[model samples]
Structures are given as structure tokens and as C-alpha cells.
Target: MPRYNMYYPDYEKLYPGIEKRPDILRVLRASDRKMRYMEKGLKLERSVWDRKKQTIASLPSREISLEELMEDGRQQFSNGPTLDEQVQHQEELRHLHQALCSLEREYQLLLYFRYWKDMSQEDVAKMLSLTQQAVSYRERYALQRLKDFVQNGEKKKF
Candidate 1:
């Protein structure tokens, strides 16, 4: 495949017959512009989220009330399970964490953002500085890998 070049002559050849239609080219250019804008917006939002996380971290210890501290402790403790449940949960978590760690760097992070954070494909692509198609492929591959890991693990245990 030809390397994608944004220059007029190159883009014209990239799309082939569509290049002859000014209207189609206009639409394609508009779509590209829109995608660029969305990418910018996602970047700004990520920056904002980073700042928020930092601000929360930087809050004064004294500002955290005793009740709030107690509640946080309680919540953390309660999030775990009883002994047997804990064993099962821990096993599953360990396998999943290992699988996640073993994934390609980009695929792992993108999978987390897409699956855990519930980000849309377009949003993920924008955030990752990749095209929609690239994001789709990575997401599909990551999911398939995860599924295979889980299935094979279950088979081994049984």
C-alpha cells in the first residue's frame, strides 16, 4: 500500500476515481477537518482530566475530614470478598492482569480506555492520534486476545 501523504497530488491518487468529483473531495476534506477538530477536543478534555487528577492529589491532608477518611477506608475494605470469593476473584484478576500486561503497549492502553472507560471508537482514535480504522483493528485484536486468554485459561483449569 502507498504511504498516505496529505499533499494534493498524493491524496488525489489515494482515493482514485473519487478525486475527479470536487463535491466528493469537498466532503472528504470536510470530514477530515471534523475529525481533526474532534481530536483537538479530546486532547483538551484529556488535559483537563489530568489536571483534575493532579488537583485531587494535591489537596491538603488536613482538608480531608475524619468521616470522609473513615468512609474511604470502609469502602476500600468492603470492596474485597469473603475468603472463598476472594480466592476466586484474585485468581481471575491475576490472570487478567497478566494478560493485560502481556499485550502490545498501544493495544493494552487502548483496550483499557475503550473497554474500561467506555470511550467511543472515534474518541479513542482521537486520543491515540490514530485513524479510526487503526483504532478499530487494535480494539478488535485486543479483545480477541483477551477472549483467547480467558478461554484457554478456563480450559487449563478444567
Candidate 2:
């Protein structure tokens, strides 16, 4: 099989101080992951691929400056399933969290205390000066809103 480079945005070049500021690497790596996700998208797009070519050239290949080989569907730097899933999940979770952030203060706290902090519904009610039933109602309402927003997302209802 022929070899081709899959583009992963170079975190190092983009962040010139990666050598000095190690923390920045984490953010850049996340950007690199998004870049990979974009490449996957190209694979999903039928127009970009030419079946007749039947070679690596037929694929929508992006050249990586790192010159990493696109030997398999997965990337070379993938350490293991654990970290890769976590990073991808964290990205998705971040999107959900941003949506949560836009919610009313009450619903935000209710979701955070009950779900994130792992507190009981009763505990959340007491903390928020609400009845347990009220907390339950808000939880249902908030979750329904979030679900609709995520699936359709007409606008920022929050």
C-alpha cells in the first residue's frame, strides 16, 4: 500500500513557546485532535473520494508537516484507547458544559449539584432552598431543554 501523510495541526509550530510553556501543549494537542476529526469528516464526504483511483491518492489526504504515515485509520501518536477516548470525550463534554453554562442560574446549580457533584436530589433541594419535588421538576425541565437544544439547537434559549 502507498503511504500518505494525515494532517494533525502542529501544536509546536502554532504555539512557538511550547518548549517553554508545557501547559500550552495540552491545548494544542486538543487542537490537533480537532484537526484529525476534520480529516475523518473528509473521509465521510463521498465527493472528495474517488473509488476508481483505488490508491492512497484517491483518499482526501492532508499532508502533515510531521510526515506521519497514515498507515491505518487511527493516528500514529495514539498511545492507547484510554487517552484517545478521554480526549475526544472531553471535547464533547466541553461542548455540553458550554451549553449548560448558558442556562438559568438555578438550573445550572441544580444540574451541577445533582449530577456533577453527585449530591442527592433532596440535598440539592435543601441547598437551593427548594422542595425536593421542585428540584425534580427543574431537573426534568432543564434536561429536556438541554436535550432539545443539543439535538436541534434553534437558538440560545438559555
Candidate 3:
């Protein structure tokens, strides 16, 4: 446990658990992570107090400056749930893989040629030896069905 002297220059300012006392904290224990997190708001001064006299002294409290720490990128509370988001993206890819696998061979080929191969409708028609109109209609219908299937599968939570 390390002691910290809370230096609030504005004596009129309000802070809990310290309003009635001489602003200096006798003993404060913060975890290593939390200590690091609050590093900017902490301060060290050799002459801030006289331990033998049990009296308060002076040192600026600049430990854990919000603006500085935020810029420095050491704030734990600032982190987002990126791990959860990455897991969610992987899960969606797995679901799409399964959905694609369940599609008919012709529909899968249509999608692969149009999207995966990045071919135009006319090119896809030429590759499949079908009319462009027929290719367009079937591709649109298949994509609609794929979207519906994916949405329904997501609703099922499986």
C-alpha cells in the first residue's frame, strides 16, 4: 500500500470521503493496473508532509490527467469490445460458408462467377452459354434468396 497526497488547490471543490478531512489521503492502495491507469494524476514530493508531525503539506496532483492519458493511450476504460466484435465477424463468415455450401450447385456457380470471379452479367452469361437476360434474372433471384436465407438463419441463433 502506497500513500498519496491528494492535492486539490481549490479547497472549495467537493470530493467524497475527503470533504471533512485535510485533503491528504493517509493510505491508498491501487492495483498495478489501476496505478498505471492513474499514473498521470499521481504526484511525488519529498517535502509535501512531515510524517512525524501528522500534518498536511503541499504538492501538485497532476497524476492521471484525463486529456494527457487519453492522448497517451493507457486508459483501460477507453478500450472497446474488439475481441467480441472479431469473434462475431468470424461467426458470420462461418454462417455464410455454411449457407453457401447448402446452396444448389448451379446457384453456387452463378454466385461464384458473378461475385467471386468479379465477372459482369454478360460475361457470366457467355461463360455459362446462357442469354444475358436469363443470367441477370436468375442471379438476382438467387441473391435475394441467399439474403433471405442468411437473415432467417441469423434469427434462429444457430
Question: Which lDDT values do the candidates have, in the order given?
Answer: 0.70, 0.73, 0.69
Write candidate 1's Cα lDDT for 129-158 as tens digits: 999899998888877887887767533210
Task: Return the clash pairs for model 3, or none.
Answer: 40-63, 40-64, 41-63, 41-64, 42-63
Candidate 1 lDDT for residue 76: 30
Global Cα lDDT for candidate 1: 0.70
Better of 1 and 3 by TM-score: 3
Tell me the lDDT of model 2 at 28: 66
Comparison by lDDT, 1 against 3, better one: 1
Q: By lDDT, highest first, what's the ranking?
A: 2, 1, 3
- Clash number for each model: 0, 0, 5
Q: Judging by TM-score against the true structure, name the best candidate.
A: 3
What lDDT tens digits, residue by residue, belong to model 2 across residues 1-158? 43334555555556676778777777766776777765565443224545788544343354443333554454656666687788999987876876787688989989989888999999998898999999999999999888876677535857
lDDT, model 1, position 32: 75
Error of 1 at 85 (Å): 1.9
Q: Assess candidate 2 and give its lDDT.
A: 0.73
Compared to the true structure, candidate 1 yields what TM-score? Answer: 0.43
* TM-score for each predicted model, relative to the true structure: 0.43, 0.44, 0.50
What C-alpha lDDT, on a 0 to 100 scale, does residue 38 get in candidate 1? 44
